[model samples]
Target: MPSPLRLHPDRLLPAEPGLRAIARELYAAVRELPILSPHGHVPAQLLVDDEPFRDPAALFVTPDHYVTRLLHADGVSLADLGVGRGPLTEPAARAVWRVLCERWPLFRGTPVRFWLDTELADIFGVTERPSAQNADALYDRVAERLAGADYRPRALFERFGIAFLATTDDPADDLAAHAALASDPTWTARVAPTFRPDRYLEPDRADWCKAVDHLGEVAGIETGDYAGYIAALEARRRYFVEHGAVSADHGHDDAVAEPLDARDAERIYRSAYAGQVTAAEALAFRRHMVVEMARMSCDDGLVMTLHPGSSRNHHAPSFHAYGPDTGSDIPRRTEYTTALRPLLERYGTHPGLHLVLFTLDETVWSRELAPLAGFYPSVYVGAPWWFLDAPDAITRFREAVTETAGFSRTSGFVDDTRAFCSIPARHDMARRLDAAYLARLVGEHRLDLDEALETAVDLVDGQPRRVFRL
Candidate 1:
């Protein structure tokens, strides 16, 4: 017989008797708080379509790089898992599901394991551990549930108790789905778009000129000239705000935000647009745009979020085959205090600026990030992100930064995920870990019990609202 799958009542709490009791109480106080995912990747169209998920494999494996990347490391091919190959037939989907089920041990002790377990047992009502023998049965059960109305995207969004969820979207997106949901009488929750201009900011990209042209076309500005190009970007950001975007998200190779003087900037822009920009000019232009993005945020009131230091798409072959976000994104050593100095020097004390800084580099959290947030009114240290969002890394993040920046300077947990169904499970894990962290403080006599409970609630509900201006 297969072992029953179950979630522990005191999962992620401390093992010590006293701390465990305190953590249990703290978790309860904030456990049911509405999830505030102020930054994420779930497509708005998913909810607007309100369609049933195609199948269990598509739901759990194909779209989630976090799942597929690991399985690939365990010697499974991306093609076999239905990645970047359009849709999968039922038999093909089940084959992928069986692949995962047989390799269940690969996920052991991972946050992916915890999240998938929660999703399987709590959301899908799966009662047995997934194994080769049970793969078909489990897939059938989940597929059957997904075929029901209650398992559709919008219904699951409501069931997840999401108070506010934001999707990262390009400037070119019209956000018609956002408007559709906002006008619907039956839908009450807020699902806002985030202004993401990654392609627009980096002019060295092969498609930069075309992207620039599209920006001009959309904004009704001329982009053959440099001034018109800047205006086009500003216009798009305003359009995003009009469509309910609260933040502008920036992810670049680095956080360097220096700007060139007007004449030099115009010179570089002309070169870039004419496909004549040198490598150094391209680097300078990209860095310059970071400052421009910050200045626009100050004027437009979009909270500026900088996610720097990712070496995105590390495997060139995989990227060429499957496209980006295929989970080869890696972290490099990032120097924030200096890299961000130019932007901060301009707007660090500007009351209108809200800059949330995220890093893939863990080393900078204590030495650089905390100090930066501690000094700058605009800078809030973003939560442990991407690779560092797991349990141990999160705990390390708290200890590293809390001493200097304190709790208020930290941006509350942002479950930056593309996997929609894992939203609640991710939020739950953060809540539990936070409770455990706070419970340790209470046990150590550093915090009163009541105070710890209040902090727990604020971490869940208040921090994201305040940091992201939700």
Candidate 2:
């Protein structure tokens, strides 16, 4: 028989009796709050199409790099899991499920394990942990559920208790699906588009000029000159605002935001448009655009968010074979104090620009991010992201930043995920961890229980709304 699976009620609470009791009460109060996911990679079109998920492997293994990256480390090929291989037949998906079951021990202490355990036992009614023996049975159960109308995208979305969901979109996207959602009287829930203009901002990338041209065409503005390109971006942002977008997301390699003279900026833009810009010139141009994005944010009401310091697509071979966000990206050391001087000097105190900063580098919590948020009224520290969203890292994040910036100055939790099924489970884990943290503070006499409870509610709902200007 497969080992029985059970999620402890007080799993992530404090171990001590007094603190544990306090945490249980705190968790109970906010555990059922509606999730406000301000940033993630789940497409709005998923609900727009309202399609059933393909299969177990396609749903869990293929689209989720977090699962596949570890499985790949165990010598399983990406193709074996149906990644980049299109649809998976029952037999193919079952085989992949068996592989995951056999290698399930590889995820023993991972956040993936916690989420899957919650998903399996709570969401899918699975009574046992995944094992080689139970692979087929578990797959059958999940497949049965997926075939039902209750497990379809919209139904599952409502079941997850998500209050607001924001999806990332390119500058050239028409957002027809966004319009469809907004106009649908049946779906009165909040679904917002986020303007993501990464490709159009960086001049050194291989397809920068073509991306710029496409952005211009989408905005119906000419991009023959540098100023025209800026206008095109501005037009697209306005289009997003009209479509119900409240925030703009930027994920660059670094956070450098230096300004450049008009002549220098124009020269670099013209050279890049002609495919003649040098690497150094391209870097400078992108840095200027970083500040320009802030200036744009000040004029428009869109909240600006930046998450940098990931050395994306670290392996060229894997990138060429599969593509980006395949879990090939790794975090690097980041120093934000110097890198962000130019932008901060210009608009760090501006009331209109709400700058939310996220970092993959853990070392900057106290050294840079917290201190920066402490001083700048416009700045707010972002939630843990990617590699640092685990239990220990999150605990350390609170400890590291609270002294300088405090809880109110940080943006509420952002899932920042692509895996759709794991959304509620991930948010639940964060709530539990936060309760545990607050319980410790209460025990230490730093805060009253009433204060902790109020703050907890704010973190789960109010903070995201305020930080993102929702």
Candidate 3:
């Protein structure tokens, strides 16, 4: 017989009896609160269409880079896992499932294991631990569940208790699906698009000119000149706001946002448009656009979120084969203090601007990020993001930022997932971890039990809504 699989009721709780009890109490109070995912890669079309998901591998093993990256590291081929392939047949997909099950031991204590185990047991009702022996059976069971009405994407969205969902979208996107969902009387859930302008900022890229031309066509502003380009971006921001978006997201190479002189900016824009820009000129132009984005936020009331310091596509071969977000991206050391001074000096205190800064670099959390959030009314520290969204890192984030910025000044936990089913699992883990952290505070007498409980609830419900302006 297969070993029975079950999730511990207090899996992430503190070990001490007193602290465990307090954590359990705190968790119970906010365990079922609605999830507010303010920044994520989940496509708006998925929820809008309400289509049944494809297969087990397509749904779970393939789309999630978190799972694929690790498995690839263990000598699994990306093509075998359906990474770059169009779609996997049921048999082909089951082969991938077998790989995951056979190597279950490899994921012994990883967060991916935690999430998959939770999803299998809680969502799909898998009663046995997956192994090479039971991989086919587990795959069949999950496939059956997915074909059911309750397991459909919209049903799962509702079942997951998502109060507000934000999807990252290019500035040129029309948000047709978002509009469709908003007008559908049957769909009452709030789904909003977040304006993402990373492509427009990188003039050194091969497709930069084409993207600029596309933006001009969509926004009805000429891109041949710097003034018209700025107008086009501003127009898109307003369009997003009209469609219920409340935030603009930026993922740049760094956090620098210094402004260039108008003459220099115009010269560079003309050169970049002509496809003759140098690497240094491209970096300077991108940095300058960051400040311009801040200015746009101040004018339009859209929250500005900065995700910086990801060295994307570290492995050239894999990136070439699988394309970006195939999990080859790596993080490098990043300094925020000197890099953000230009932007901060200009709009750091602007009453209308809300700048939430995120980093893969944890070194700056206490030293730079916290202090910046504490000082500026507009600056808020983004939650532990990308590689730092694990249990230990989440705890460290709280410890690092709380003393300087406090709870209110920090953006709450965002799931930032593309796996539709993992939404609840991710949010639940965060809630449990937050409860445990608060329980420790209460136990230490640093915070009262009642206050800790209240704060725990706020972190789940109030914080995201307030921080993202939902």
- What TM-score, over all chains together, does every model reach? 0.99, 0.99, 0.99
Tens digits of per-residue lDDT for model 2 on 1-470? 67999998888889999999999999998999999999998999999999998888877888898999999888998778777777878899899989988999999999999988998888789888899989999999999999999989999999999989999999899999999999899996788999998888888899998999999999999998999999999999999999999899989989999999999999999999999999999889988999999999999979999989989989888888888878688899887899999899999988889999999998999889999999999999999999999999999999999999999889999998889999999999999999999999999999999999998899998899899887
Q: How many backbone clashes does every candidate have?
A: 0, 0, 0
Ranking of models by lDDT: 1, 3, 2
Candidate 3 clashing pairs, residues 3+ apart or interchain: none
Q: Candidate 2 clashing pairs?
A: none
Tens digit of lDDT per residue, candidate 3, span 1-470?
Answer: 88889899999899999999999999999998888999998998998777888888888889999999889999999998999898778789999989888888887777778888899899999989999999999999999999999998999888889989999999999999999999999998999999999999999999999999999999999988999999999999999999999999999888888899999999999999998999999999999999999999999999999999999999999999999999999998788889989898999899889999999999999999999999988899998887998889999999999988889998998888898888888888899999999999999999999999899999988888888888
The regions of model 1 sitting more than 4 angstroms off are: none
Error of 2 at 281 (Å): 0.9
* lDDT, residue 364, model 2: 95
Model 3 per-residue lDDT at 26: 100
Name the runs in model 2 displaced over 4 angstroms: none
Global lDDT of model 3:
0.91
